[model samples]
Target: MPDTFQRLYELIDTPRFAQGGVPRITTRKSAEDFAPRDEGLDVLLINTPVREWSYPNVLPIGQGYVAAGAIMDGHRLTRLDLNADRRVPISTLDPGYDAWLFARLDEALAGEPDVIGIGGIITQYAQIKKICAYCKDKLPDVPIVLGGGVASAMPDFMLKHLPVDYVSQHEGELTFSEILHRIEMGASMQGVAGVTYYETDSHGERTAIRRNPPRRTMTAEQLGHMPWPLRHLWDIENTYRVNPVGHLNQGRKWNQGAPESGGKFSAEMIASRGCPYTCEYCFSDYLGTAYRSRPPADVVREMEYLHYEYGVEYIEVLDDLMLTSYKWALEFYAELHKSGLPKRGVEWGGTCRTNILANDIVRAAREGRGNMLELGHDAGLRRVAYGVETGSPTILKVIDKSGQTPATIKTAVQETVRVLGYASCSFMFGSPGETAETIRETVDLCIEMDYRPEVFFFTTAYPGTVFWQLALDKGLIRKSVDGTVGPADDGIIERYLMGLGEQGDAVRTNFSDLPDDVLLQLTNQAAQDLNSHNSHRHPYQDGAPNSIVRDATHATI
Candidate 1:
């Protein structure tokens, strides 16, 4: 199911909404004033909501500056510490419910664009469908295209059901351009690689969908050549407000002070595509094993543009695996410092394998104004994990976690903490061959790290992984919470979908050596113990964004 839409999927996240979920409301009372319709561009791209960010009490603080743990300072938090850092929603602080986004789309569409493409992964599938429904009624003549991992994986379901006329799959930059051109020229879409479309049968009924072979993996040149939309496309003037949290660096103690004044924003970018490590549960297979990244010069230029043009103070680097090569990382920092954006006083960080955090590389990143990181903490539990997914060495072979071992992981974690100073670890529970001893091993590691905040996840095989195929082959799926497996594929699909779409839901799809109930209990208890640091009291103890259209100065780092 890997498709051209992988890039689109990367830009999307699973926070805020359950997978395959949609907002209860659709279409404002008014639609004629939508802005993007008037942008006069050939194509309009909509990066719909469920964007990865943290929100207050109800929303999970999956990724936030406040997740940075403040020193206990001999101050044990009471019941009310959580609300002390409560952030006002941008919706309430500005316009509500992404109305601003719709407003911009309306303005662009008002300019009479040739085509409109909407992209999101499973997290936003239902939302995408809802938007497509509204778009169909509003812009009946404009050909609507759907692209992203959700489209690639669910082409049939989307193309057949949703109002979208075309679904662009795997690596969409080239395919999307061609799609727009073909639509404009009235050319047949037969040969367009990495696209799926439907033809009308003689009776005017939708026929079987057509798919083209996937295009080659994206290259560094190709990625850079693509419209680097640092300035264009995004409604930055409106949405790129600064974070209320100051300068946004780690070790900055939380302010019990009033939420600060506004006029700020944070931006995200990727200097690269594809992670080098082959963590089996990840969708890296879809990304192509070959890692590709932009030139350090290009990365720095974009950072400069974001900082100067957009007033972006903190930028999050969104590479799943960053710092893969020390030389590449060094070049990146050297370019940044020489380029003087380091002098611009911007802060940046990323989530990547701890193995890449060589002491020198970490030193360079700090020297270049980089701070904060989410390292691959899986390697630290040598006795309990390999790349963070197995307890038994035998299971490592089953999961195909090659090029990694306990010793290597231990060294990686040690080096990361040595340079970076802090780490937030998330690990898998309920893996094949798991046992009480293995679980205790993990607990020991956590304690060794000083209960250095962790999240334990129930392991389930989402589609498009070596793990999924293995589970299917070995019949580890359950029909219901009660662990029923039937003769048909319905339960299997149900279990898989739940795993993919719902992160909070526990899935027990591991081999029979370990029972789901026990696995669930272990993870729950571990999380409870780790969270005694008053997880609620420290909710992203950072700050929120300023204005929806624009406001807020800093965020918790």
Candidate 2:
């Protein structure tokens, strides 16, 4: 969110500003009054820190260098992705962490910035209260704005609680600009699009209003025109050491030297904005449904720049599909082949819909080795899961996704194997009406498939998805996460497995009770079983933490 805001501010300087998520990893840290740049006071972004679950370094939480690169690029209009813990383990701190964040915020407040922006994610809702308390403590005089996925998805909840100066729901760029403009010009925050805030006349009681901000979708061409991200504004370099994932090992160095040997110099390139698939358990739909693409030439041009200017050897096409259109994909590969700019070579990969697989697309994907293809096989037991929610049709209708049926998935897999030789198949186990039997059915179907594929037991519940909202509304899950799924060390795998597998059955039979140790044992056993059967490599073992993660007591887990 800060990255986005910073980029936007650079483009228009419209009294708008962006910041980053607050660090929640330790209690020793504290927030203070922010320092001022030439433009204005710095906005401190805060969020929950990771202290749990150590596995799968893929798809890392991008921060620091990655964010810096994005800032250097025009892609980021408003900067965010400050704390790069992708699968952040859930952990809680005594009031100290909050106090620190508040202290830092107080310091920023002392500078009397035009407006303070508070960015929150669904997982960080509980932690946000502390941020609010600190903001009020130090800068009660300044206005605070809350925005981002968590706030937008549940505006009513944020408005009711939390000490936010204003909640900017939905896409916040313009709404934030309007709010900032109002604050700077001494105008009323009324009519600021997509914002939820307090009303002065109403005695500081929280108020909710629907402000219609213009939808300012940037084209790939237009993106080139935006000011590069302001990397200098963030403590990016420090966060890289903290990111659990290994995104850094993949991308190349900026010295224009040789590619990092063991791990390729890979970077995620968002060729297009939005996903065409609306899988119930996926996040693509929430990001935005509007499908837009960057010109292949422009993208290739950037690739060359990265290759020559910065010795990037591999580029991961982070787009929903690198081969959405066969012609486009082929042309992109062919251009790179002809450019000879990166004569050394480059490799890359991205998510693809199995149903859209084409021979040409597969052939193009073969351009560079170590390239991976991610296919969203949400459910192996399509029929059962599709039956429970009955939203499959709606999803298909809305997102126009292919491969809802077993036959299509098989074909897609076959095509992937034929073209890419290897692929990552994502699988979701539990859903609204899912049971052990149904889940087994899905697993069984995967075991039956001829292709050896990578698989993950993707949980059905999470924020920013139709399934999560449905689960919450149906009371399928507890309203608040008790570090069970939120914290890094909360035993996410154990919690989910104990609820759905053999141990879960055992616990149910034994008075519906299960110990954490039992659950952990069962979860590990299940993971081992699944790993052994599917021939899928264990993500936990690959580049896993070599040492124990340190705790406050000097003990490592």
Candidate No. with top TM-score: 1
Candidate 1 residue 170 C-alpha distance from true site, Å? 2.8
Give each model a TM-score. 0.67, 0.62
Per-residue lDDT tens digits for candidate 1, residues 287-372, read: 44468887777777777776776677666665666556656765676777687665656766665453344344456567784432
List per-prediction Cα lDDT, in the order shown.
0.49, 0.41
Model 2, C-alpha of 309: deviation from truth (Å): 5.3
lDDT of candidate 1 at residue 46, scale 0 to 100: 54
